[model samples]
Target: MSAYKNLVPRFLRYVKVNTRSDEFSDTIPSSPREVAFLKDLAKELTQIGLSEVNYNPENGYVTALLPSNTTAVVPTIGFIAHVDTADFNAEGVNPQIHENYDGTSVIKLDPAGKYVLDPAEFPNLKNYQGHTLITTDGTTLLGADDKAGVAEIITAMEYLINHPDILHGDIKVGFGPDEEIGTGADHFDVQAFNADFAYTVDGGPLGQLEFETFNAAGAHVVIAGKNVHTSAAKGVMINAIQLGIDFQNALPQDQTPETTSGREGFYHLMRFEGTVEQTTLDYIIRDFKRDGLETRKAIMQQVADDLNHQYQNRIQLTLKDQYYNMVDIIKEHMSVVEIAEAAMQALNITPDETPVRGGTDGSKLSFMGLPTPNLFAGGENMHGRYEYVSTDTMEKATDVILKISELNVQQH
Candidate 1:
């Protein structure tokens, strides 16, 4: 079957499995539903004639191998995609298919007209004119973020198996869980994957080829205050909620996710909850440079330290490093990047080398010695309602995978 013909159904099937990951869970896969879906995917890989189909229960990764068909010892290539969806409502995802989308119409997502996908709000919708777009029902995310990548990888592998004339070296494919929570690749066995270089097909939009990502850290701040009755609030009441506001004001007001873009660093406050007695602030610090990330972390600590000094040590701050920029590792292996660029050129797709403002599995995998970069999977507005993927773009992504394999063999 053609790649486009196989892509839609395969993608639809994968997204409906409800593999949404949890950030708070302590399990290996974060959620049991992820394990169940991955187990089934493992069986499917074996049935598709892949070899060494092993599902590692310890890390919730399913890896399969397609043996080399040529005698020339070419470097092995690996394609990876995460099986888990973002922390969005992914239950009973009823995907809506818009065949031959008109460029300008406001497509209503629900029967009640409460949600709509308008070209005005998302100008990129015009690019998919006359193409098939897969979207959610406005109640949940479409989960196309990485599912499109998973489908494309599997479909491309099946194509290579069917076409024996396309000689290539051994190709490895891995699908892991809990990527949405940023811990899926923490336990990734790079030695077992055994690829000289790899690509995580988890980027947004078509033609996006990224290697640089934010150096990240998470910060937790707690403020403790003495609560008193309103009538006796003269000098005895130290409101923790007010202290929380003061702490936030100490950070760079202009440096935040909303005000920053491309190569800029920011302090993103992800969560805040508390009462008069105690307030906690959860923040994610991001920078493209390691030194910049450290500076951002230090700023948070300085803020807390200053507050604690004035309030008799009523504030506590904790910071933890999350991931680093993949470019630091991928730069040394520019040949791998050149290969992807050439593949896109051959397919007449313009290569967009935009630096990712956020990190991916590739960020951690590169540090793990995989030297992985990220490729596009045709998803747009990921991780929430109104997320969509173009079937035409997905077909192109599948073709890119095949082309990359062919080009690698030719180069070797």
Candidate 2:
């Protein structure tokens, strides 16, 4: 477990590859640049002694299998991480490496934004006072989101290969592109992955094990109205801009992201732009319970119906289901969660089992019949320049991966 001495360098090199996923792209990986990065990763996996390492440049997915050292038969578990950085700027990612911190004000050079980790703004700084904190230089984001997770998982696998005496079972490694924009699992070959249960090592902070995520759907609302001269507008004109505002007001404010947390779902307004003649409002609806999720969709429809009744069917609502809660699939095989829980406990980290307010590749993987859960990558403030990860937590996350491999055999 102590072989993480050179892990940071490997991870930093990977992040510098510019594997950011783009939502605007039609390709599965979203970016062809990710394929070049996957090639290097495949080479590293082979260098570290992972078996069956395969690099598919066309779709940009890298997979490798770590053979079991001990004769103990355990459930073949998979570890997954994403390679792409978020759509945020990756130019000049001057990652600040604070070897040992005194919990003082860590500043970005020429800091201009209101996005710093000040004690006054973030009281959580007190927690990592004495440890190492790696942050972006207030310019580009440090790709600690899932890159940290990918590095930790691979680092842990290397440790297992280096130490044969530490009994463990077979482990599979999966690294995909385009997770940031939600297409990481779109082209994944789960049957080829060949793991009964898996975990996405892509959660925030440490000891965070999530098997439940939001049942998500994107709602697009459109309104049609007639434009007329202002003097004659009273009788001939219909205003879609006002109708759009009314539609937003119709939803409960308390059910939004700012007011909701945990299993409590919310309606996230992704975009709201309109005009007097035509308006468009895009929203993302999320909830854990299937019935509650359906109820929310019904409420949205009801609002649209009422508006249409008033405006002579002028408003149209269209929804597309993004993803579903993976709980139903993951719960059927509860031992996978227990396996991760016991593994983290074995490594002396108190596991915090929480529902993800957001979705992950794990959400899609579980529905794909892999029954994947998520593990922490020891990061906070993801997808922004304020992103950072603790060296201690990253190392522990690696240990958790190793211990999970060991615990799988103990269960056998």
Candidate 3:
């Protein structure tokens, strides 16, 4: 029997629900389906015998507590994962389960054989040999970026609840929405959570742990122009679409997501809409260092200013800081990281201390006075159609969570 017998079923059930968040929405959860999923999760937590189960619609966070089974006064630790998937086609997600994957064959994803999970493209698939691999059909994302995390956390908590011999301190579990939209931590109640430290079960690959993340910001640029008949147009009319393309060209072409990796910052143009009268461009700025992030933002403003000067001040720019690197906050609470590292070591899972290329809810929470780090939940190629999760890796992550709880009591 699989050690995590309940983990697979739980993940499959959660991913089937379309919980993709909307970036354009102003509401709390950003989508109605996310609220429904959060409510269902709250009930499930209660059914699993977790105490103090509550879901706040105002912020769309579901929180539950597992009372301490031991008298040791260890720090109250929290486990967190987001309920909503990324901005992808999440409807009709038919999960494909491949048992005892040989790790050498191309896994067909659709009846038409349009999408194949090939090892040649994704070399990481080779690591899951002899393990059960779960993926999605060609039409939609697998939702494994975080649904796997959600299942692993809940299964770990269930394991603790069933095994009375395993002693632990007060444990808290949180499920939130809109993480993919970068607003998951906007209204998080950190003070009420009352945990000295926490971990976001939202990292990729097995044994991956993260304490550093990108200093992130989003920029919106709008260009306005007067339109005239093309036959009579010369200096009398300005083409907004052409001006928008010029603005993009003004930025460093080499400093982009496609050309950068491993602490190298990039300006990613996420969306572009254009017409003869008006054009809008959306971009995200990321860097490991705060100074670098600020410089990048300044460079964008300078480009906008230069364009506006030439175009009679017709360009408008808005840049908003989303989250900062959690390293500065987590460094002060190194024991929180040490506990997770020790837990992984205890289970013989070599910890991979990697810096996150993207931000997590913990990145924002760490700044909110809760020293939270990220732990892997065993998914690969997140946020897309090629997403997959190894059942063995997820089982190890669950063991890490349980072991961390136990280690906290014993070490303290």
Candidate 4:
């Protein structure tokens, strides 16, 4: 907020911690590294003069409170971000800094030029021509997905602690682990993180403000087959792997992650493991509406039903809902969205009210009685090696946090 005074340094420091989460791990934080980093962050919050700073090991969240300086009644707002990176290589993340980018030059991410960040492919690079850009060195991911959010939140809170004259009501800050694997907020203690409403500083690009996210569900399909000797396998054997492929073909091929955009829904085949005796297919279904998600789920069920009738009940399908669109809960509390939009406008930032294609912790938190909207953290091309964040945009994001805190009290 103070013109990148602490934002860039904090971000650079946090991204190097190697807090990548594991989807296969059954632990609460998913990774032991995340637990250690979260404990360190809890200590840092306490050292920064924040009140009630505590790390709950049960939920793996470090929560703190910036107590109000004013006696006037105002709603207690919260800000949340995650500490874990996505399912990518995050070891020894050496960030590259490009100052005053010329807007047209190609960015070689490695000495061998194996990975390059070019304006022709990523035209958003042109938008931050004169701003500082932080990117990965092509050896690993930059972890800016939420580290940028974590840094911005802490910097804005630090600024408020330094300048108490800018009075406001109580502000809550929460940082959690394992968000990348989609289970971080599953055990989140929303009651303990008490706030009237919250905002997730976990969006991409500049001016991104989102309250809508995909209505998500995960499906697991297993097919059983009779394995017979090839010498006598003439009508006695059923190949489960072939049946799995048939099931996949039955789904709409045109509707997929690469082929869809905006509000369009998709059935993503994430993992497929098979053998002649048995095969398993793991899929994630995403849609913006609940009915659309249900329709997709029904399609999977019908595929299983038809296949089971043919194979004598050799197929098993399990479907589970992951999260819902936060807009369904946020629309009733439009003030939360209006305050963020007003804050961005006050800082001369255009409010991009685009819907997120994926889910955030807010997607679950909003349903847990906290209506949260998402604000940008200035990162682009998240979850991969080409990921980058604009320091100028991060400073603006921090300023938006401060402005939102200030305006919440002024308007209330």
Candidate 5:
């Protein structure tokens, strides 16, 4: 058997569980399906010999503790991953396995159409030739976004449990829900977790270590217009679709995901659907700083005002704050970042410290008093049908987890 056989099998099992989080749901886990999945995981944790395994259905936080074998004043560390998959279709995920890939396009079957993982579109595919790659069926995601992280953390813990000679301190495992729906940390119990510092194995793309994320918010615009017959209404008719277009036109043409990179922020229009009676526009504002994030939101307000002014305040705007950057909180304790970097270095992996363009649960948990930083989970093109991960990269990520545990003991 391969060295990381357990990791792959564990990931496969997790994908089979239907834990798709719902954005419209009102529960903590968002969907009732997550409750069943967490119970299974808790049972597995007990089977793996972790003490005090917990699965709280009300809050949807799964936790477990691994006691230190040799207590030498080791600082407690934590690793966390969300158990839920994205709202995107996750049914019948028949992952195609490519062993010893040869740097070529791999085809996947989908009901919509046949898709290919071409190296031309995905540049990172070139780095994994001659290694295994597990891809989706072109219809659904592989659930490797954070499930890979979950499997990796559990597999590493299992390794340490089997090897008792490896002296370590207290370690905590945190599993979240509704991550893809943006409420992963809504009920995270930082004080109860009790870790000096934690790392969320929820970062995307291998070798990624991010302490910064966009200050994000969601905006909803409701356009109300007078209903009138097209043939008889000349001056009384106000087309709601035009008002929605006017709202979008006020924003900068260049500031978008397609044009922005690095630290540049963007006001993204997610979706807009409506007709003359009424229209709805969905927008998200993102930036690295709170001021800028607010500014982008203010720009949206201006757009709404411009349209409302034209339509006698017919547009109703709703803006809701989501999450913020974890960088400021992490700076207070740089040791965690250094330890992660040292661990990566030990594995011959160079750490790529970059600001996350999107938010992770770690960012919210840090503000909640956990001081969590994100560690890469070896996945790419996440929450989409084209998602994939290099088998060698997954192994490297597991190695990094092991080294991090060892280094945490050594440094403390």
Candidate 6:
């Protein structure tokens, strides 16, 4: 594998820019800082000699192309990664690099030594022995969930551009914002990208090649109540907060995110805000099968309806389908999955084919006329302060991208 010396540096530089997205924001990128980063990334793409570099401020998408050097009549491939981080404190992100990890001692993250990344708590750190690891300062997430992927894609493109001897076909590169909030691919122009198939470099750990993702939906429950004086509130005042709790309690206790794993569907109550007069419950529903997701939604509605009937219609429910499992779409284009597996096998990286517990931008892209799959970005403990990524693993991911490109041409 070629040495990708700049991967860690590029990731550190990108994560420090404060690109945390807002889920409630009504903007394309969901955060203003993401636009600034997109501008800088567009310029960086142009500087790195990628052709047709363009940043669409309208949708907060940055795209470019590396035209094929050979006339192989191969399928045009794409590599995509989101630019925005999750809903964590991404401001003032100070990345710490631990070179040649010994894999036994605990890594102190904060200057006060109160926060640490211990191998006992996160056993995955032991896998990075003798590899350089990049982590946050225990105050914010490392943003390696996808930024590592962004840097790896850029590094791979640079490698291909530098080594002209390795012939390949036209490769499309995309960097989008708002993936953490599930709106990253909302405005992606699939026709404009024009790739037959694509891979999202946005999964956790190494060798994670995912084509199936959760069939997802969002549910909002609003409870309205009449507030009266406590002394004179007998039979007149209704506590909305209690009613919200009742609604939540009505759901199956065992079928929740905390209790389920490995293709078991769950109804996760993400946020709850309540007062005496009104209350709001935000829920996320996940299932690998479409019918399972429908069953979950139906049960939620039934619970709400039963409560409303008993309480004279004081509860309202709104369930919106977010994204569907990509397995249905990917099954039609099995070659996309086969190509990625073949590339990983060529590099001797054991392909870990697993279903994503959460939805990805690829889920939406697959439904939008592109057979896109998710590839691992080599990060563990994502969306938190303990997030860390192995530089060696990221270099291998870059090599996988290049190998996929090369193998695609050779097979064609």
On TM-score, the leading prediction is 3
Give the TM-score (vs. native) of candidate 5. Answer: 0.97
Q: How many residue pairs of model 6 clash at the backbone?
A: 0
Q: What is the C-alpha lDDT profile of model 2 across 1-412, one tens digit per residue?
A: 3468877886677666677777888976787777777788899999999999998765578999988877877778899999889878886677777866677775443357556777666556666877788888777788988889889999988888888888877789999898887767878899999998899999987689998888988899999989998998877799899899999999988999999877899998888887899999999999998888899999999999999998899999998888899998888989989988888887778888878898898898899989999999988888887778888788888888888888888889
lDDT values of the candidates? 0.93, 0.85, 0.93, 0.93, 0.86, 0.92
TM-scores for every candidate against the unseen true structure: 0.98, 0.93, 0.99, 0.98, 0.97, 0.98
Better of 4 and 6 by TM-score: 6
Clashes of 1: 0
lDDT of 3 by residue, 1-412 (tens): 7777798899999999999999999999899999999999999999999999999878999999999999778899999999899878999999999999998889999978899999999988899899999999888999987998899999999999999899999999999999999998989999888888999999998889999999999999999989999998987899999999999999999999999999899999999998989999999999999999999999999999999899999999999999999999999999999999999999999999889899999999999999999999988988889899998888999999999999989998
Model 4 lDDT per residue over 1-412, tens place: 3455878888999999999999999999899999999999999999889999999989999999999998889999999999999988999999999988888899999988999999999998889888879999998899889999999999999999999999889999999998888899999898999999999999998899999999999999999989999899888999999999999999999999999999999999999998999999999999999999999999999999999999899999999999999999998999999999999999889999888899999999999999989999999999899999989899989999999999988997
| Stretches of model 6 off by over 4 angstroms after superposition | none
lDDT of 1 by residue, 148-176 (tens): 99999999998999998998899999999
Q: Model 6 Cα displacement at 78 (Å)?
A: 0.5
Clash counts per candidate, in order, are 0, 1, 0, 0, 0, 0
Q: Rank the candidates by TM-score, best first.
A: 3, 6, 1, 4, 5, 2
- Worst 10-residue lDDT window for candidate 2 reads 106-115
Which residue runs does candidate 5 get wrong by more than 4 Å? Answer: 106-113
Q: Whose lDDT is higher: candidate 4's or candidate 5's?
A: 4
Model 6, range 1-412, lDDT digits (tens) per residue? 3387777779889988889999999988899899999999999999989999999888899999999999879999999999898888898999998989998879999989888999999888888889888888999999997899999999999989889999999999999999999988989999999999999999888899999999999999999988999999999999999999999999999999889999999999999998989999999999999999999999999999999998999999999999999999999999999999999999999999978898889999999999899999998999999999988889889989999999999999
**Cα displacement (Å) at residue 127, model 6:** 1.2
Model 6 reaches what TM-score against the true structure? 0.98
Q: What C-alpha root-mean-square deviation, in Å, does candidate 4 show against the real structure?
A: 1.2
